[model samples]
Target: MRRLAVLGGVSIALVAAAACAVSEDVSSPPHEEPEQSIPDADVREVAVGSDAPAPTRGLLCSSDGWCETLLPDPDLVVRDIWPFSDRAFAIAESFTSGIKVLEWTSTDSTWRYIDDNSQNEALAELAVGIWAPSADEVYYAVSPGTIYRGTRPVAPATAWSWSSERLPDNNPANVNHGDATQRRLTLGVWGTGSDDVYAWYSNTIFHRKSEGGGAPAWVPELIADDFDAPDEHIFITGAAGKSPNDVWFAGSRRRGTKEPCDVLVRKTPEGYRRIADGVVPELYSDPCTAREGIPQVVGGPRAWPRKFQSLDGERFFALKSWNNFLRIEPDGDGYSVNIANVPKTLLDAPNLISLWGESEDRLWLGSTFFNSNRGVVVRGSQVWGDGGVYEYSSIALNGAPSNGPPNQIRGTSNTNLWAVGDRYALHKTTP
Candidate 1:
């Protein structure tokens, strides 16, 4: 669910930080590069990808910012932002036929190829994220349920030939893991020599002991039928809570009118149990009211890998709001909910409230309003980015916070945190 850079009047803020070495000026060589056709060399067209273009109708962004239009291809959709090392921009770009990774370096923002593996014409492995069971290499999931991957440092994906590798189930075109399409699989990523993976795609609300696998397993045991995630549109929004035992999976359920939607959360223990729904207002065109298009769940996405608020034993609370915020507390049987409206102290703020997290004591909230998707600054009842009660001190920032804005954030250790999603991924430590 990537927001394609479209034709918009985007506000371009040239943060003269160290990253802009990404500009073509620094990446391109003396004479080997192609002539710049567009005015803004900052924005580059994805030569090969499956991501669909946004509206042909552009927006009036600020002066100079990054934006692009959605193409006519129906299969095209930006899958996920590739993880980064020290000097590379790794990206997962999809195609109607297959998937590929467009890799580039800071020295040259020109994206090259990472993996051009064997393809299955019958089974177009629409690759998603790269998981590391260990550090030796990385593997890309063709999709969530099916786990086909390549070792790290994926190459230009052009060599793939369909009908090559065989699966244990013998199903080449594996899309859904089991008989259940209702279940969205989430990987319990682990590491050995490389990143190993586990899954949760069960028939009933997934119970902890269930088993699943493709490359990563998708247990059908995790989702309960009573949980109420729409059959078709329902998807895993994120796993909220603090620990594995306390984890809660977030699901988006579409109901009644096509556009109007609701968010669902089911506790992931003993099996799935209903926790709450529609914590945030969903966009709906009443049955009688004429609607223009679908109202999107802005900032609503399954917390990217390492993006959820979970530690070994604690599950962080989850919240979302446009004008207000929603928080939940587990009751003996059900759950108690609290609603907080974004105070004026932070309403007119630059970024919109997307996520909030708290440690044992300090509470932190983050926003990415408009296109200013900056790092989540620790804020209280105040605007983030502009200035917040909590500025990241060098000690707090000792963790290599993604040099770029975290499309998603997750904290594992008191001092170790990980953020993924956006073009640049983050692995930071808080001293």
Candidate 2:
């Protein structure tokens, strides 16, 4: 096991902002775009299907639509992949081998094991999140309040060196009726650069900043008790921002199974503030505890916004309940919220899961249905400006398997796109 470095403290204040709402009725006709067809020669499956020794489950596509799968070990299950221009990094876990970090380069076209978590069971089994600011630097977050940093090796070294840091454990044993273990689990890690990284677990957010002429250290940015009621718990699922001053973190707040509310908080030049609060009907059957309502759709367990992404910092998109999608833009002092539902005329009962885009008018949403073999990718184009409606169309996956759904959609541009999930990876080179 690696020795853990204790972190220092920093004090930050939270400010409550006035809730603002600008609702738009999206009853207009659904906008549609013509789908492109890829030639048989342009698409191919590498190490997928039942015949391969270890099926490729994780994939990364370069800026030019060149795709590769990450499968260094047969028993690994990849949780996340982060890509750079020429190299990529992934986090995978195995019951027998523990946690593994794999690296791939465009030149080699093969995945290589680059991490050293094999001896530490806790680090191996619990590392779930990864983010690379550059090919030389990366950050991995282990659940239960631990983080690891890896830097590229110099000429004499053959491997990367990793250092560990420990965060303040807010989840002491037996708290919240012994369910505090869930709160200790880190959700993810993200940043604009190497110096401005952020990580959030269940309810707490930590920031990594440099001290007086020494290495950067993680410090508590926000804690649950400072923001929520004694009975309420906040589960941060996703985060994104235009820059350090305009970042946003979102998730759901629950006070038992009966009440689940949507949470949207932002960090500006001033400090952290709660900007929006609404209800998540899919998580609870009882009445909503709506304080200031953001748009929501009524449906099953997948109703809440699971992930958030933005091409530019001014506007953001998130996957919502069923076929519905969320669009958030900067409004006067708050944000303008719009919930766009997939037209029933296009598809029936599609559960949108992943989102990626190149601009406000050009977006791709990935959908997978319950008890179904195939999934669909929907393209959304803005029909107007903020609070306006979006036109959506279905994109066909030519070589992807029937049983696979695009769990994640990412690309450098519309001309070079990739959708990967469920043992399959699909790439599109045409706009």
Candidate 3:
């Protein structure tokens, strides 16, 4: 198998040497630094509204605590939410049909369905990812690697115009194009700006760059082959970045059902390269065989990373397992990995699947399950001097129904946050 060469003049041997010094064993307890002082946790009020609506379907709340059901249809299962200053956009799946795009503006104070009629039902049903940099521009990704771009029309044209394109299909034999059973589904879409956007499926990362001309088309920027993996496939589950020059993709490499190892690659001005692997010594063993005797990495994440989000591009947080997460940041010329546990005391639920934040000090996480009684959302604040420790607190959802957990959490700022999942959507805004 082929391995990536050294990055930015730093050889992989040198990178490994530097990582060994700071890398924590996943099985061991957190190493405390006695010389470092932990910062005091920030305090904020939990506002309760007098006429708050019951969180039966979902709830929207302000900082002072006024809440109401935010979904236009109670049966819609919101998959993701993108909040803006004057409006917000969401993609939700219904019990009877596939996914639908909805919009809510400050002027209207209501959610409106905005998907194009030209989009076929098959593609619509596969829509799972949505990202909007502004009200005028949005990008949606569907299963089996199809992307749709929607743009608001000028005056005299009240409707938005949409164009669709498909990402390269490596395994076209998988006709189902489903995410769970196949590798065709587009996992997520994100970008620093509308002109430079990105979308990724299982093993390929697609890029669309428009340069002062008509519309540009999505093109394959990177693939699993570029990494020279021992296995035929690498599962890329999430993507995030600070800018066009600095983007990150994370996932795992599996030798069939056994011997799974972490895979992390970053894209810089230089190009894309793998920075770290086999992070947990126990799990990072022999990629060629289904070996059983290899020791498991202790204190490391319970599973491979499935999602990632960055607060400052400097520090990226990844959701690996139900109660465990990872903090990846630059270390010298390369990068280092730090595994941290979620404070069980702070979470009422188990599956913390969604992650978002306004800054390094303030972060938010959401839990998920079909029929969870307590839809939990936890806010984490960094404890200074501690290697990536945080003080976590469960945000109170005063009128929220115990119907289901949140699948996603997003916000424009610390005071304005939104969490949507199952059959509900919750919003927190300034009073």
Candidate 4:
């Protein structure tokens, strides 16, 4: 749907309905620091390293003879890209019909897939991770009602040698939180650590430490032991693949009462814990009043800091401004955040810019902290590799033709970087 056409309630209901299962809240040790001691998180990032060349994959391409090939028409739509092993990498592709696992030779840039007809369905939204513990990747195929771990490679899919009982199909919007294909599906997903796996499912959150194989074995735990009780509800929002325990979600309800309306968090071994105490006051004020009051207070939980990610699966960070949180310098010695302080003429929501990164360095990208109206793009520092901040229209597969005022950084990783919703909605960096 176009950004202008998305209805807050309807969109939420459409997605929330199918995802109406899971649960949580987060709690932080109170700091003795003064109220003003908390500093903004946007630090102007500097180019840490150089464009340090990417290992060239010499794979030649067969042209579709359609669009401008020179303009960068790498056929395989890359849903997600990350180091598969020390030398190889994998990109998940969910095209028109089925899903595919493209393993890159990194050296030859020539990547192939385990093409099995049954393997074809919908790959996780390109940006979403296609769990590959070893070489065989693991993913849930909702349309076919199966969860595939990686099959024999043939043409365009993993053609996994096996399949399993499908995950419950409670997704309302048919989207995958990982990529456009499953953005709204709200499939069970989580990270235990760079190597562990996590899944926040109905009433329970499952955790496991394993290399991709057959069924996912996990230690069962309650995301919300009392979610059945009135006032408690959990909905996961942002998560990390590097660390499954670093999962984050939103919920509503007071701890002692069933008032049921609050944001929460749940980590490995941790139960559903409240993350926020109260909604920003500006949310209750009239828009007319809010425009003058503060943009940070207008939206609801939508207004409350909606996305969260692990700062390495241990400490967590949030992009909490409602208007437009601009110019982030994660590596900056002191700079943390820069609110709509950017000149408004070139920007839109000073707070809604998209946020994603792999390391505070390259391997990630963040939306423009300034000029969001025109759209902004910030590259990770060279520390990881390519680092520099640039501005580009936040356009990608499964993305709105345009989602100006509301660009989402998604708070995953640049490698985990992907978008869903439209043909152009699902955006990925490498693939």
How much lDDT does each candidate structure score? 0.33, 0.56, 0.58, 0.33
Residue pairs in candidate 3 whose N, alpha carbon or C atoms collide under 3 angstroms: 26-298, 26-299, 26-300, 27-298, 27-299, 27-300, 55-401
Q: Which digits, one per residue and each the tens of the lDDT, describe model 2 over residues 137-160? A: 888766554577777778666667
Better of 1 and 4 by TM-score: 4
Q: Evaluate model 2: give its TM-score.
A: 0.71
Regions more than 4 Å wrong, model 2: 1-70, 118-120, 169-186, 212-214, 226-230, 278-303, 373-376, 383-403, 424-428
Error of 1 at 375 (Å): 6.9
The residue-by-residue lDDT of candidate 3 on 46-136, one tens digit each, is 1211221234554444343424445656677777788898778887777664567778766745677777633344334444768987888
Ranking by TM-score: 3, 2, 4, 1
User: Candidate 3: deviation at residue 182, Å?
Assistant: 8.8
Using TM-score as the measure, name the better of candidate 3 and candidate 4: 3
Taking the tens digit of each residue's C-alpha lDDT, what string does model 1 give over 1-431? Answer: 11211111211111111111101111211122123211111111223322333445542221111112222233323333333442232334334434555443334323444444333332433343444433234444443233433444236733322111211211112123322112223332222223223332222222212245323332233332222333323334444443444445544444333442333343434544433332222434332121122222222222211233333323334444333333333333333333333344433453333343544334444444334444443334332222324433121133333222333333434344333333333334333
lDDT string, candidate 4, 169-279, tens digits: 222222222333323223334344335655543233445534366544444443443333332333344444234433554333222222223343435445433333222
For residue 127, what is the lDDT in candidate 1? Answer: 44
What overall lDDT, based on C-alpha atoms, would model 1 receive against the true structure? 0.33
Top candidate on TM-score is 3
TM-score of each: 0.44, 0.71, 0.74, 0.47
Best by lDDT: 3
Report the number of backbone clashes for model 4. Answer: 96
